[model samples]
Target chain A: MKPILRIGSGAGFSGDRLEPAVALAEHGALDYLVLECLAERTIALAQLRRVADPAAGFDPLLVRRLRPLLPFIKARGLRLVTNMGAANPLAAARRVVELARELGTPVRVAAVTGDEVLELLDPAQPTLETGQPLAHYPQLVSANAYLGVEALLPALASDAQVIISGRVADPSLFLAPVVHHFGWSLDDHERLGQGTVMGHLLECAGQLTGGYYADPGVKDVPGLAWLGFPWADVDAEGGMELGKIPASGGIISLATVKEQLLYEVTDPAAYVTPDVVADFCGVRLRATGPDRVRVEGGRGSPRSSTLKVSVGYRAGFVGEGEMSYGGHNCVARGRLAGEIVRERLAGEFAQLQVDLLGVSSLHGEERGAQSRPYEVRLRVAGRAEDAARAARVGEEVEALYTNGPAGGGGARKSVVEQVGIVSCLLPRDRVRTGVEMFGP
Target chain B: MKHKLFHLAHSRAGDKGDTSILSLIAYRPEDYPRLCAQVSAQAVKALLAGLVQGEVRRFELPDLEALLFVCEHALATGVTTSLRLDAHGKSLSSALLEMEIEMDRDIDTRIPTHAHAHTPTQGS
Candidate 1:
């Protein structure tokens, strides 16, 4: 058995920096590079794009991201895995093949599909968020099950150099290669759980390497401008050490690791992904050296019988308008502009939110005893059923310049069709997964 | 002595549906108990009364000297549906750090005096 397997995270999210990933591929000496690009609402929005154009559902940055790394994977024989195939994996796979051919680098690509289960969804099935039936949402756009390591293992087993998927669990993207390389059984929940700990730690790429951390005077992280992505050296037993390229910038201390360990995690004892119920409660981290931390003591139990499905539906439009007021009683002027908009559009929309950006936008309306600010931005936003109704909200806010509040400059307005996402649990057997191969 | 939670701890916020998950870790392990005592679920809910409309649950990880808070109905109504400018509630962590806590005593002498000094490398 291999003493240690090296896996590097390329991109944490859809819009993460491309250079860090290229740096990993060129310098990290990694056996596998996993780019976890899909967010909870990404696939639903991708589904909307697919409706507009059949071949446009994949991540927009897929080709731009792959263009730089194709040479390293082709030369070093390194494998690549990603959920960049947000709504369509086959098309993404085809695009990769075309890019490889253009670069004169021959490679095999695999597309993992069957996450989409819109047809199988029953209107009567209750959702997890509101406990309301699926029928309650008439404009349902998409339903996708979160696939696990099992879905990607077949592609890994194949000769495919690149594996593209849609809506796979984020951590599962890293865990699949570990399972395949070690020939670990899917039923081995303990090792799967330990492997999951490594996956969770590395999935956010730069986050593990101190990108999101750094509070100048408080928790200081140096060289963030050129922050390096992270990689894990995993052993057969699933113990690992997380580190970054030595020449790269960033810190890998207990603070960064501990903060990321519980990120988005509601329960450390039970972090449920598709493969296993990973127990991070007892996990330990030790700073072995500069830019390196050893992680161990993670355990797991049997996998859950149900898989989480993200349901996306059309939730109407959000109309927003912003205008600035400055110099002398700006707070009062901003509030007056907000009140005028609220009174003009009162009872017209389902919900209207007005706030003075400099003072009361983020926390809430209750501002207790604060000094007057020289400038404040008046922002008015409302949710409406149609685009025209939403546009009216911006029009009223813009009218504040001449009609109501003085010095209402730099006015900006936008109308966006919102896609709302909710979750539901479906039996694992209900969702079928498959893989397709493409080559130049 | 009065101290802002920001001086004692640092936090990061994340979102799932309409729920916001914030992890608060003490800068020093010795301060963990103080956070456990003062940063109760009730205290957190009351502090974030404007954003959080549901129950607040806190989970402790004594080993890491950290506290994880799960606030339901906190993201307005999830990221995509929420009309707030900060739909993901990413700034809520800073908001939570604004809480005031009455310290049991003055600063300890053992604490590093060069806390703000940015060393080039933490280790060789």
Candidate 2:
């Protein structure tokens, strides 16, 4: 087993910043960098784009996120991993090849695929929570089974400078390198679980570092504007010390670690991923130093018989509009403005949400003991089956400028068709995952 | 005197579908016992009375001095479809801070910090 594996988090989501990732590559002296960019809805949106243009559907910002860091990647041999392939892995892998050639950077790249189980998805499959069949949905847009590290190992084995994948489990992107380098048994539940927990912690990118940890005076984060991404110094035993780059501007305290450890975890005892069932309840953590935490003791059991799949279907459209009102008793005017729009769209939409932004959106029904605000924004949003019908809500809200509220300003509106989702379990035996390599 | 969870703990919220999950971590290791006693699933359910349409399930992580509260059907719909302003129910973590938990009888301050001194939590 290798002594230590240093992995840097490049980007957390599809739209995460590249600067912190570049900083990590240049100065952090990282062995591997994992950028988890895919989300549940992201794949569905990408699938829609792929339908429109066969050449598109991959992350549009993939090149921009990668081009600047090619030098660090080439010179330092920094093996980078990201699921920025979105819905199109091959195309995305090719983009990296084209970009590398353009910049005279020689790096082996690979894309892991077979996540798209759209064709195999049967409407007869029962949903996990609701138990209803997929037939209940009107339109089925895209379906992908969340893959694990088994697909990523081959690509890592190829000694690639960068690895791109579509729809692999977020944690698996980071876990693949550890498994590849250490030659750890995939069946070793405890160690896999240990590494998986680290993946989950770093998967949110800047979240562990401090981007989302801030709450102003209550939970203040300094240098937040220049927030750095988190990286880990992991051992072959799967234990690691989590820290951020110098001047990364985030606390890696017991609280921050604990918060991230439990984030999105419904059950502390059974945090399920494709590779292992991690039991985070027994996990231990302590403040190792400034911007660092020594995290260990993550336990695990055998993998689940079935994998969770995110099935996206074409849900209708959302119509939204917002207008601000200023100067004296603005709440009344904002309320009136929303009421006017509500009356116009009555019975035409499924539901209309009218919010006096400063009052309802932030304060809820309770204003506490605070005095009334000088300004409020009238916001109305609703859903419909078609674009024209959905567009009516926003159009009516805009119409209220001349038709109702006297001093309404900054009126904005939008209509968007949505990709909705249903969750189902797929049998483990059904999926076949593999990696394809490209570039010099 | 009664103390809210915020006085002894800090929380972060995340969402999947209609459910909103908040992880509440005690500021000090000594405060874990208080959290175990006071932050019951029933109490969280009651605190989110009208806001949460479904039940609240609490999962313990004593190793981390944390409790994960999963509030089901908390969002009107999922984030993608929900017309709610916050979309992901990001504000609900602060909303949970308002919940009144039983304070120790010896404690005098209205918003008492935990027994442990503050570790430098600020990042710069």
Candidate 3:
């Protein structure tokens, strides 16, 4: 891996641009291709999908596209690693296997689990803050721990071409391939730190590139469409080179890289993870080139005693409804309707307990006060039944189209009633993360 | 509220080493004078470079912004640093928040050792 071949991960696309990601994989001849699509709301969407169809798993967009690319990856013999298996890796594996067989590619597939800790949850257990066990909240829905990539090592070690995991920490998805291939030990703090950093940058894909950064210069790079995915050629020792595929859209400029660097950091000295406490204080970022940003100089120390667990429990119910109003009084009238809806709900179903997420409201703007052209969205959350009732609230506003202020036609659809689950993270010591891996 | 915290409690837990992605956001750049009176990047860098006893060898972040920094670490220190409002004084608190705080880790550093070559290579 001399001169270390590497590329930026997907440039902020949610694996939907599989064509470009695969193209990048082929062109870059990458040793590893990591696809990350999980986020906070993503978990909720996954749960909803599971509810719709237990066998259905992941977003299915990657596997669907990968079917065509499997031949290329198989011919090039590149490894694929991703956390696309939202809640069920095994099921996702089955889907991948089916897709591969259909494509007539004998690709080895592996699934990693153990992140879901819902089965270990006891209703009688109290909240870490409140002594009362979680049983009090009957709304407890989904609970999962942030599974590290330690378990995926064996699968990758087996030389599996495709490794699918459930709820893997986004950064770990990228780090696992490097660790497994390089055979890095469990305690190499510096190397793991490097892997983790790489994963973080790759996890967001293009966001670290020019997608989020508002660069003044360098326009007409190409279609933002068909963006390239990121890859890394990591050696055992922990040094890395940051690069991306050729002809990829967007520039990895200094401003772009800097914007991503400031994505989610609290302090420079105590940057912590389940694996290590990285010191960001001594780090440096310089634009190596158009799509290349160089990173060097970082410090690390031992981790704390336990890994913090991210557990999701059923919080309450929420319903979101939207209506589009065209014309001059759009923003103002929309807000007025929102206030009316809330007042009506409070007056009628105060006990129903609905919280209105003033749709697109600003930091301190008074409701219905802003005068701007806008679409209005109203969100209400409470008990399950309350959320259902809130969905009906949209109808009342629809009825107002004929009699209400600014009597003009408006359209409302996709009245959604959903429950919110809150993950009260516990220490890893308190949760279980054990899963059995089956192989040939 | 609905976030997955990659809590790097400890950095030296494996042979693979540790890393992180950090982001920094600066609330105000004009407060540099007051902020310099309070905290310095050099001080933070020194703290990171300090010879801490642990398995984590080094850490880094690739990019940084005005008041924000995103980074990955080799080892994680669970403890958090608190800037007491009273310690900085109320007059400085506003400026402190407005001050562009540097965050984000994206580099890999090695602990100084007597046996290594110019730059550490693959094998131990």
Candidate 4:
């Protein structure tokens, strides 16, 4: 076993930049580089793409992200682990193999499957929201369970240079390498939890290194545009020392670490993952030097017998239109423009939200007091039964440029189908995850 | 003086389903107690008022000098369907941090909240 394991973060979400991740592999000197490019709805949407074309269903930005890092990872002998496969791991693996061939590099990739639990879902499976039976929904686009590290053990055991997964837990991707590097058992909850903590911190890439942490004077971070990706050095005992790419601008203070530590986490004492139920409350974090923090004192309990599944179904469609109104009384004109669209789509729309950009947009009426600016953008969005009706919300908003409000211009409209998600818990015995390696 | 929670502490907001959890961590180790006492779930609920449709649950992590608050139904719907700009409620931390809290003594305003000299301690 290696004395120290260094894992670097690539992209936080699917659309995250490729620059920071490239910096981490080229400069950070990583043993393993992970990109967590999947979210709850992202895969469901990807599944929709797969329905249209068999080869589709993976992350749209996967090729661009992998292309830049492949040359570096290949030269340095760095391993790439990611959940960018989204809905189709095999197809994604095939695409990656093609990309490697074009780059004239030899690479090994692992494509794991069986996160989809749709086959096992029954009428009895109740959703967490209304606790309604799964059968109640006639249309379900996708249902994938959050798998654990065990599913990745085979891939890590092989000589795979890249490990790809569909919908495993974000932390599990990073934790898998730590387990393989240190030879940690699946039941080693304490050390697993420590490794899991490190995974959670780096899972969001630039978020930990001040991309999402900056607030100008309040929380100033230099070179946020070139914000470096973060990585953690894990010792045999599971002690994690966190830092970012060299010469990359961003701070790694106790505050930045603490924010990331608690990001997307519900309970500090029971941050549940498939590998372990980590307790972040007990985790200790301290600054070691500039752009570095020593993180330890992580603890955990056994994981739950059941794994959570994110199920996506057809909700409806969303239609939106926006028009910018400038000069005197812009807010009033914007509000008036919204009223015009509302009146036009009256009975057709199930729900409508009117927002005046300069004064009160996100909060709507709840944003009681308003600010009067010379320019205001009027945005109107609605829910409709079909895409055609949803598209009308945008049509009526565009019509306002000529008919409804004075000094109105820059009309933009779009109609998009909404993807709704419901969550359920499935027993461990029900899932059958397996991994296979592919190379060119 | 009425000081904003943003002035004395740092927070991170996250969403699960329709719930949004905000973890509030104090700048100084000694300031944790006041935050625990003052920044209650009720206060957060009151601060966000109409935005939160359900109950607010708070968990104190004295070990990290932090209090994590889970605000249910804060997102109009899950992010996939939410029409708001801040779909995941990423800005909710700033909204909660904007809350006014009464303080008796003046904190050294020179040091930023994310700045170091942080004394690490362990207690639950």
Candidate 5:
């Protein structure tokens, strides 16, 4: 009714940091602040944290940031939403409510649950990539379904002003408020499509607005003190404008927008979600100027039967070791050492996938096996059964010091086992989005 | 006629093992309850043979004054990697429009027009 205003809000530069987030919200330029704190590994970390200190888990630092900014959010009548509750939204909400009461701000907090499928994990669900039942490994660390904006609608409608969620789809935070306040239905396919595209753009905050853009020459876009969070203005006609805190740092350009559009969405036309099958290709990106890109003309259809689920598993143990090279044959020397390790692994084991990072020449390509580099670190990944051999692989890399390359003396670094076989399972049942409205 | 045809599409599109659903038709705001009822009737568990968990989402598009029920989790059937209907599959909208209401052809054509008539002449 109020010309549906939406924005993308996130922390900048800091990894899972929330101090900056609270500072941004304190500025009061956004209607809804969506924080993305979930990464493949962060979820795993949260899972581990919850095990030891249930209350200590989650990125509480962001909640601390929100504590100082709650007064401003309530004063400005802005609402906040975030997935900082990577493992526990309820516990996270309890802490927020406590903080709110402490500050004398009667802000209500709602926790959207039923996303964590870990409870229902059949240990039996089949992996989409591998036909094996997820239950094959019982020690599954973490399993969650990416909930859409629908799940946040009820809490948002309660006029809580601040909504905390766990494992929500990264883009849903940006789109949920728009859909709820504007009273948009799931079938408003086109508008939902447009809104989703906008969410995808803002989900990463500065990532698109020049935070990680491909532009090599562009520098400093001002207002760096308070980085911008993403938001949008949607109308009755299904039109949306993607903008952020006007005074925030960073630049939004066609290149940035295009790169963000392709970030996780592989297919432009068949961008699938529980709500709708969005058409990202139909989006027309125009550089209206410096930090502004106008997106329009996107389309969407009713979603097909299946929800595209993101399943993360401990596929296998992964380890990497780096060795430096020098002299005229620096490049050749690195390759020779890598070859020696590969040759040893091949002779000893089977199906060892090795990758040379930092030194790949064709690193620019999204999916490629060949690359040229001065120094190469061999990376290997396989089943836990290969852990012994993998550890041997590491030993072999260190052994290369005696058998291969010029700088083999000090170059031989011990192999560090970074990742292990993780059992990940997705339950058949998950919580669908529900709405709860409050007010006269 | 539209509902019957959509039901057929829903049956064909429903897969096994994967949680997914087929939306035979998009609904309007006024049609939300109806859509909800229809989705509720098509229990996600029933369609997946009680092996998978699923739900039906009624996507409301106030802009177009339309609603669509997305049968999510129908992919529980693990029918396919992609749930999008093949281009050759009958278009839901066209099928609804082309359906001959043997009982009221002329009246059916007037449905959309009458719905539009209820819209306010001025913006709220």
Candidate 6:
């Protein structure tokens, strides 16, 4: 049995930087490199693109992301796993095969499917969030179950060098390889839970390495510009030490780890994922050395019987416009401009939101007594059923230069179709996962 | 004396649907109890009265010296659906740190007073 296995995170989210990931593949000496690129809304957006073109649903940067790292992967015999496939793993796997051939570094690839369960969805079912019947929303676009380690095990068992998937839980992307390499039983919840702790810590790439911890005077993290991605060395028992490349920029301290440990996580005792009900309350982090921390003591219970399925629907369109005003009473001019747009779009939009940026934007209308700023940006946004009506909100804001506010400049407007996501539980037995292998 | 939580603690905000999860971690282990006592869910909900529309639940991790605040109806909505510029509510952590709390005079010396500390050298 391999005493220890090293896994490195390549990309935290879809738009994460490429250089940090490249740094990992070239120097990190990793056994497996997992790139977690899917977010809650990414797959739903990809589904919309798939409807327009069957092969266009994968991550748009898949090729660019893989082009530079394929050589390192091939040379090092390093296994790669990612959810960059988004809505189309098969096409993404095919692109990997083609890219490998073009680079003269042929590699076996596996595409894991079965996360898409739109056909099994019943519109009459109730959403977990609102308890409203699915049929209540007429514009349903996609339904994808969050698959677990079970979905990727078959691919890992195969000789494929790269595994592409859609909608696999983020932690499962890292935990699957640990379970595979350690030969741990699926029922071994303790190890699975501890393995998940490592996954969760490393999942956000730079976040673990102090990308998000810098607060100038309070919590300063150096070398953020060249912030390095993180990697963890895990033993058979799930004990691990997390670190980044020595030459890379970023700090890995107990403070950084503790912050990420609870990020996006609500309950400390029962952090639910597809594979296991991870209990991070018992987890511990120690600063072993500079840019290195040892993590242990995470516990887990049996897996949940149901899988979370993200259902996406067309909510509506958001129309927004921004115009900046400077020099003498800009906050007043900005507020006046916002009032002008609100008046013009009265009764036309379902929701109208107005803000004088730099004055009272982020926290809503709760500005305490403070000195008035010399400049402010007026922002007017509204939601409507159709694009034309939404566009009118921005048109009114843009008209401020010629129609209402004086000295208005840098006017900007955007109208985008919003995708709404709701979650519901599906019976675990309902998901039938399979893997298709391809080679160059 | 009343001191801003920013002096003794640091926080990170996360979102799930309309709920925003903020992790408040004490810089020193000795300050955990003070954080638990002062940074109650009610206090957090009241501090973010304008943003959080629903209940605020606080989960404590004594082992980690941290407090997790889950604020419902906090994002205006979720990231994709919310019209707010900072839809993810990433800045809420900083906002929460702005909250003031009564701190003991003796404990004030424990907090870092410098504006910057040199990045620790390797193997320090």
Superior candidate under lDDT, 4 versus 6: 6
Chain A fold similarity by TM-score, each prediction = 0.98, 0.97, 0.83, 0.97, 0.79, 0.98
Q: DockQ for all models, in order? A: 0.45, 0.41, 0.06, 0.52, 0.02, 0.45
Predicted complex 2: CAPRI docking category: acceptable
Write one digit per residue (lDDT tens) for candidate 2, span A101-147: 89998778888888888777787888875788989986888888888
If both were scored by TM-score, which would come out higher, candidate 2 or candidate 5?
2
Among all candidates shown, the one with the greatest DockQ:
4
Q: Which stretches of candidate 2 lie over 4 Å from their true place?
A: A366-371, B104-124
Local accuracy of candidate 1 as per-residue lDDT tens digits, A1-440 = 66899999999999999999999999999999999999988899999999999988999999999999999996776999999999999999999999999999978999999999999888999999889999999999999999999999999999999999999999999999999999999999889888999999888988888888788767667789999999999988888988899888887877888888889997889999999999988887777777878888888999999999999999999999999999998888888899999999987976798988879888877752275778888899999989999999999988887898788899999999989998888899988899999995
Error of 6 at B6 (Å): 1.1
Docking quality level of the chain pair in candidate 5: incorrect
What TM-score would every model get versus the actual structure? 0.96, 0.95, 0.71, 0.96, 0.65, 0.96
lDDT by residue for model 6 (A225-282), tens: 9999999999999989998899998888877888899999967789999999999988
Chain B TM-score for candidate 6: 0.85
| Cα lDDT, model 5, residue A113 | 70
lDDT ranking from best candidate downward: 1, 6, 4, 2, 5, 3
Q: To one decimal place, how large is model 1's interface RMSD in Å?
A: 5.0
lDDT by residue for model 5 (B14-112), tens: 222333323332212344344444434244324333222445443332332223334434332232221121211222122222222122112222123
Candidate lDDT (C-alpha), each: 0.89, 0.83, 0.50, 0.85, 0.53, 0.88
Give the per-residue lDDT digits (tens) of candidate 5, residues A1-440.
Answer: 57657564665321744544554566636677777777544565566678898785676465566776778676767777877776777677777777778888867767777666665555566766446786664446666676776677778777576677777766677778888877888678888888878777777676665554321222223444444555555665567666654566665644345445655442456776656778876566554444545677778888555444444334344333445665455656666776777777776655544444444421212222343444444443322344564467667676676776677444432322222222233322344644322221
TM-score of chain B of each: 0.86, 0.83, 0.22, 0.90, 0.32, 0.85
Q: Write the per-residue lDDT of candidate 6 for residues B1-124, one digit (tens) a residue.
A: 8888988888999999888999999887778899999999999999999899999999988877899999999988787788887899998998899899897664443445222111232123
